[model samples]
Target: MNKPEKIVAEDLSEAVTYPPEAFISREYAEAEPDKLWSKVWQQAGRVEELKAVGDYITYNICHDSILIVRDTPETLKAYHNVCTHRGRRLVGNNTGGGPKTVAQDKGAHSARGSQMKFGCNYHAWTFDLAGDAIYIPDKEDWQGALDNVCTSLTPVQVDTWGGWIWINMDLDAGPLREWLEPVASLIDPFEFEKMRYRFRYWGIFDCNWKVALEAFLEPYHVQGTHPQLIKYGDFYSFSKAFGFHGQTGFDSKAHRDAGTAVETSVHRAAGDGDPRTTIAQMQAEYWETIGASTSETLVKTAQRLPLELPEGTPAGEVHQYWMKIAKEADAARGVTWPDLSDAQVAAAGLALSIFPNVNFIPGPTFSLAYRVRPWGTDPDKCIFEAVALDRFGEGEEPETEWTFVEQDLDKWPYVIAQDISNMVEMQRGYKSRGFKGNLPNPWQERKVTNLHRGLAHFMGTGHLKRID
Candidate 1:
């Protein structure tokens, strides 16, 4: 709608001293890894990860690699990923797990799965799929009380939503949904269950984790960090605030509406090369040229006559077709399209950066979701794993996995690459002598400040006492 005036340094100094750069330091990240990660909630994996019984995925959070297993369609569990005997990491392979008796094929499009048991690969310390230690290796090692004394793997508190499984390390912590209150409402309208996961692409950035996250929170940097996005994209105003558990940021309604329009420059290009006229003609040519979509409806409605098809057109089909046309228009003009499948887009292009270290991006037809785990208690360097979800009918599976594909590089390459890099650099910068202090841009960087404030509040630090 309107440009946000940059606040002068004098004005910023009186607001918040937590500079934008404070989020980019290694020392800051390492100082309270446990304090930051353990007390708050962390995302584990998606429900689709353990799609079948005994289907399990191992996740390594800060200082902990957990083994998550779906023992049955209804019963799911998470365990510490360490071996019971030799203490080696259990379930080293990505696809390693238990039997498939835990799930069932009730009907097409139905969410059902099952698993029987789990075992450590190091010394074969076996446990039920529910994390109960069932069997030990030795028979007469110490005494006759082995079976009575030995137990299953340690369990973590978990919660599920939109097909995702979230875990909290705090045993006495509040409920998962309570903590998610900050972002759940911001993203709940997408109804992510209907969409699927496409492939995820990740790169370590040159900045701190917060820097990478802050880059995504606002559209303010779209003019510079991603110049190409400004072509069909908007970067005028932003909505920023502190949610119950996380921070919230979004573009203005004008920006959202502006992005739907095709650029006038592209409209003029229609008749130049192929003798076509108007924006629609240019888009049609471009779509056909690149084998993309050019549905008349997806073109900015203000630019052309609205097409009214026969009543026989299915409502869902109409929307899909129009979306395809819009995507084709974007591709023809070199617009940065969300790298997701049709399923993800239908689900919603909206994403959720759940405070500490989880981001759930629901695309139009598919979704790109991931959880960042601290690397050996270092919050800067994280172990990132993304799950791409898509729904196939009964007896159907994707021929090739698309969740691991890296397709959004053109639009946000620098941001993704800069994330891990900044994490390490900031880790080092926290100890810098030249680092006087940080002064955050209140209007633009409110979410970053909100995040810092949340962390401080959760950890019982009085530094962010301004909120109180």
Candidate 2:
């Protein structure tokens, strides 16, 4: 992969735009498997899902399927999820979903399991969870043919971080921690591994995977896209690149005008009016709209703040008081919070855009994350998934499972439903001859440009578009 020439906020102009082809071109989508997915560590599933030996999950990217298995109490392994005999999928055929494929993969044909061995019904070739071929159907019929063949399943590099199981197809790829970089360090203070899944939502979308991700990368669209939210707080943003990754968050006008280091992800919303009431309303709105991001305890605490404190309380006092009450409530329930310094929490920000295809917003006791994947080789179709994580007392974690919802906007929470509307429109707008390319907010949408540069880099290409 060639190094991506750096393009900073100062280098951006209207001409520095991503062409529609970058989002809707079939040619660009087809090259992703080799140029993007294979070169990066892709998150597969959470560690909590595979607590027992033999437990496994199948992750599908493009046309490839990877099987991650817990082979022993302390060992986890990953492999090509295909049978060597005839190239049949070891688990159900992940055919990217359709009524026909669903019918084809049911009963004896479909499986995701915890078993001592994965026995291929095709000729009864069996392999243990460790991916070693322990049994074969015919022993002596092809003794010489089988003797020299290394029947071990093809292995992939696998590791864990933030309670996620990440697999890299490039056997020589760098460690997950290193690849995650300052982004990992920025959010590690949140102690995500201690949180449990509060909810998981997934659906097929009529947009490029990148389109879905970019929608959440910045709050620049808040006034235009979610105008109703503006009454709660100012959503002006400051975005910046961080090596291979980037970050965007709400920042004060003072910081934005003075050109100081940005630091306002966890800060309370403030307007000309009583900031305490404004922030309280913002928390309540977040709970009702996205149903995640902020903790329920905090939102409830915010609702009762007016009665808890006298009128005209200082903004700092309100924020501190709100946190104090919420923390006490959490402690009473045994939900331990991370001992994060104010700086660490602020730096973590509203969200992080992990290179290639991951985005997350971290909080002390709650967080929300997104992962997008292309649906087969189609640029205009993708699978978008969202997960809500929250700290819970020991043994009190709620049992949750991945749930699929239809693409109908009503099926999603109000805020995300609005985002989906934008995603669909943006994909459709690519066909417009009048529009040239995206005019990103250089100061607030730096992450979007940084991401494109990362994609261009790994694909061994110059900028995907040039004005002249």
On lDDT, the candidate that comes out on top is 2
Give each model's whole-structure lDDT: 0.48, 0.79
Question: Candidate 2 lDDT, tens digit per residue, 1-468?
Answer: 323244434334334666676688888888888888888998888898889998887888888888889988997999988877777777765734222254445322113568788877677777888787788776668756764246777889999998888999999998999999889998888988888899988888889999999988889888888989878667887777787688877777565532211236543645656766887888888899999989988898887778888888877677778878888999999988889766676677688877888898888798899998888888988889999999998898999777787789999999999988899888989879988777776677888888887877787653634344
What is residue 116's positional error in candidate 2, in angstroms? 1.1
> Which candidate achieves the best TM-score against the true structure?
2
Worst 10 residues of 2 by lDDT: 254-263
Candidate 2: regions farther than 4 A off: 1-15, 93-111, 147-149, 254-263, 461-468
Candidate 1 per-residue C-alpha lDDT over 1-468 given as tens digits, one digit per residue, 9 for 90 to 100 = 111233323212235544333354445555555666666667665666676778876655444556677777787777776666667655553211111232332211112234476566667777777666677767467577555334556667777876677776677889987877746654455455544444444433333455445544544555655454344334444334436233323334443422211211112211122121233343454333321122232345213322533334443344444455656654565433445543323222223467766655443334445554444434444344445544333334343232232323443334343333334555567557787555555665555556666655455442332210
Report the lDDT of model 2 for residue 432.
90
For each candidate in turn, give its C-alpha RMSD to the true structure in angstroms. 10.6, 3.1
